[model samples]
Target: MTTETVAQALLDAQVAWAINRLTGDELPELAAKAVDDVLAIAESTTMSSLADPELIKSIARTIAATVPPSTAASTLVEHSAEVVLSNPAGTYTLREVVDRDHVERITDEALGLTPLVEKVLDDLTHSPMTAAIASRFVGRIVNDVVAGNRAMAEKIPGVGSLVSFGTKAAGKAIGKTGEQFEAFFGDTAAKGAEFAMGRLNKIIIATLKDPATRDAVLEVFDLYADKPIGRLDKVLSLDDAKRIGGLGQDVVITAAASEPVLKLVDALIDGFFTVYGESPAAELLDELDITRDILVEYAVAGAPRVFAAAQESGELDRVVREQLSPFFSSSEVAAILEGR
Candidate 1:
């Protein structure tokens, strides 16, 4: 699925959210409803450019005239995941018997959201809140991809739906929606959240060991010499702010910020930018090698804590406030609160 696919799903779910809030248990039924509505909308969208506003308005009028609101017209969302993953008897093939090699491929897709999540964390200039929110957003997105991939990957002996129904049906049912879902089910972080996590986690560990993904992550860490600005100085972009608001910051940040060793290198970029302004970019480039070593130390020893001399009378505020405080305090804690 592309951006459109996800966006449409999100839209349908939002509408479902409004409805499901009426009764908590209505979520699955509402999800089923949302899935049906989405399919119908998808069907209508195929013959028209519903992607365009004018076309959507035109279709809206046509629908208003031709289709009256009712049980069918009120609409429900349908998920092909259930239909695809299940055999005619409706048993899940993945749990019953998984193809080890194909399983490996699906695993890669699930863990693939990390770098993207880490990048958002590293780039947001002044927003701990946003960084956190983006982490959770990317987590769900990646999880969905895992579900889709797993649903498609598991071959139940004779079925041929490309994406398996049993897999995604199970994945979505595990409560991967929002804060309540995450709180109750533990989402992606929990090792036993779902069968998908088992496969997804194995792939993540494998990706960590893979020379390519590992090197890429390490390379990002190598760039961690940039200083970080204070909370107000955080230079959050409009897009990032919107996305962060769209998702909860704490959940996103907690999950996303857990990038094994990559978080350190990524932090260095923020820590350094906070320390030195853009004017030092050239000088920083010169010390790139040293920076890489320091970043590695950051990964190993963690962000450095400024000493009493650095923070006592606010020495950090004097010359290094933006650069090192809050990140690693004199007490050796630097996970400062960011954002306004």
Candidate 2:
């Protein structure tokens, strides 16, 4: 046969061999060997050589820009909500998902932000809007109480007429003087409102700082932990889920595109590179607790199903032939076959 014919025959044989090896009983062994070879290479290669921080940042930007439409987000959320609502109430309890220690830790960490809470409370209490609201609220309560007392007094048998006359007269006199009195004591009212708000802030701060607060949280968690997650359709309708999901998606999309979020993404990527850039890829995998055996096991378990599908689609033969054909058709292979 001619050199070209010989090369073509060899290429066909090589492709067949490759397909047989991938599909035969020795497939698991091949997979294990391949994994071992990859890990061996990884042991010599650093993570930065594979993926740099800039690439990761670019990927983040791409993901942020490629956010799905709100309608799609809403549909997905609605479907997820339906699936969740259809599940049994006892599918998973809070206690099963999270331990008491984790709950306690989270609660303690949140409640430890006393300074932040105090600052927020101080801002609210000292605001003009809050003072005005408090003053109006107190005035409404006082007026309600007086009206209630007058109503009750008018129900009395003998003194009803006299009480009614005195109330009307008092109301008229107060109406004439009330505006002047308010003008005179406006500053005092504002101060009083501020004082009331300050008192409320103190109470709120005290309640948060109380040791019993933690216990109360724990008790509430305990009460909820054992209870099965009942149907949530009544609490959160599908329409509500859709609306919330769309809004959440929009918010995420907007935030992810914001300068601060982009900066944060870059910072995180840089931090990761700083920690792992120089380390061998194998060491990084080890740090993640992935071992050689686990890698082999996963490869072996997943290979058959993937190859089966590829073979069914005739893709395995096509890929094997495609990979081998280039080598056989090269000038080097032709020269060797021709005894050059």
Candidate 3:
């Protein structure tokens, strides 16, 4: 929280970033070479130059103890909220930050010829969970429709009404009996529920695996995939754009200082290092596709949408004129502008 500590943290982060770049080559051969080089150097390192584990632990503990979760969380949320809320040109500033020219380049690099949509489709289709869920949904709809018709018929005439009444009575009696049985059988209810769910899942999985169901799902995907981006032009048009932007901006401006936000902030800060430390960080990074190239590419590809959306909402002009223009304008220029 002191200037010195802040400076040191920045330097440490820079060193870590440097090390990551040095080791994380896209090519396997280059990565292997980098690992070998690190190993060779590490082999030659003296004990005196090596970091003390106990001392490192002690320092980590000291830093953690100093930064109380409640205070740290509150300070971070308050400061960030203040920066956005207190600024006269905050919305404009946000637009300017988003609209920079580097965004397209970033996007191009990140989105590099990956056949992203196709990959997504392939992944979804191959996922067991997706197949299982889809089958279950279809089964549930069929069952509901059939059951509804029967139930509706039971409520129609005199005999039907009597049958409906009897059905309800029977259901209540069965439920009561089941509860009593469960009470005597300890975890019988839980086991029964689990068994029922497992059987339902199996049926759903079978339905999903059916040729007709699978073909129908794929056909839907194919139809959608064939549609042009222009099909979405209306959704991203000015009226819709402003509504979306305004809603998001309103939520941020209004929600930042709330208790729920502070709780989230606290949880994130408190768990940050601990969560990642439990796993091999390198493996986690690889699994998550957190390579520098991928990250840089995603940022470039995605950054421009922020600006484009802001411009669509007429926020970009406000940012440039209100927030940026005055800095270079002298009193005479300001007066002339005022006169205009």
Candidate 4:
């Protein structure tokens, strides 16, 4: 009731906690129950010792450090950033877990520690294990702690959550059956994708608030628009990759991004010449609008035909004149044998 009594009660409470921990029962019940009890004690006294903001944080740090982390639930709850934000112990313990997990462990325990959580989520969402699980059980979990935080991400402000989701997805996806993968897409099979388009959409729409992102998002949608409608079809169709080969493009591009796209682009470029003959090359050249500055980049990118076109169009000389002419003496065009 009184300040001294409340302070003494808080001290006693903390002592009891430390004693319980030290005696080695590792009282799961006591530890778990303490989470609620401590909050209650703080609320009851209006400003008990445990209620001291500074003290509360300090105790939290201690408890988290002292707690066991081998279990999945512990990793999910106590070692995560969401918990760390609740008190000092959580913050310190989570930071420590993150540091340790980084050097070697893969840090699965500290799944959601930093603003970087988004990036981790994105990576893990594609992780075969997480994806396998999410592909199977995502309807139950993907939407809130999974999907909802996508909206809350900017508020958290970083790439961590997205990366985490992706890592989880990929890891889970590996072991999963086709049924599992289909489930993750929630009937639409959105690339069987989790955070990429979602987070990207969240960001672009929030920033542009118009059809500005419409094209970008549509491009992503187009990727899977025809490939396979469900995970069952996608998995079953992988065999078609060897036969049809085009499916290989989808597999390579969607399974891994950017790098795979680079490979696909290279393959497509090679295939254009290999399969379609020089006709495709002519078609591509015609499709290119040499009139635009954009064409210059493709020209400079070292595509053989693009360079050839640049030379024929006289743009190579123009490009050199525009970009390199300054380096020359500029008095006159040097004749190859004139100097000799």
What ranges in model 3 sit over 4 Å off? Answer: 1-147, 222-340
Which prediction has the highest lDDT against the true structure?
Answer: 2
Predicted structure 1, TM vs. truth: 0.18
Model 1 is weakest, by summed lDDT over 10 consecutive residues, at: 331-340
Worst 10 residues of 2 by lDDT: 65-74
lDDT of 4 by residue, 289-328 (tens): 3332344443334344444566678665555445443323
Q: Which stretches of candidate 1 lie over 4 Å from their true place?
A: 1-101, 109-114, 130-340
Error of 4 at 294 (Å): 62
Question: 1-340, model 3: which lDDT tens digit per residue?
Answer: 5444444454455544533443344334444455556445544553324444345545554444444334554455545444443443522322234433454455444444335533454455445556456546655876698578768887777667776677688779988997888679755644454444455555545554455664564455445553432323334554454455455545654455456755555565446544544444444455666665564555445545555576678765555445433432445544544455
Residue 215 in model 3: shift from native, Å? 1.1
Worst 10 residues of 3 by lDDT: 90-99
Better of 2 and 4 by TM-score: 2
What are the per-residue Cα lDDT tens digits for candidate 1 across 125-220?
235445345455556988799867665656554553545565556657754565565677553434323333334444555665566874564444
State, as a TM-score between 0 and 1, how close model 2 is to the true structure: 0.79
Local distance difference test values of all predictions, in order: 0.44, 0.84, 0.52, 0.44
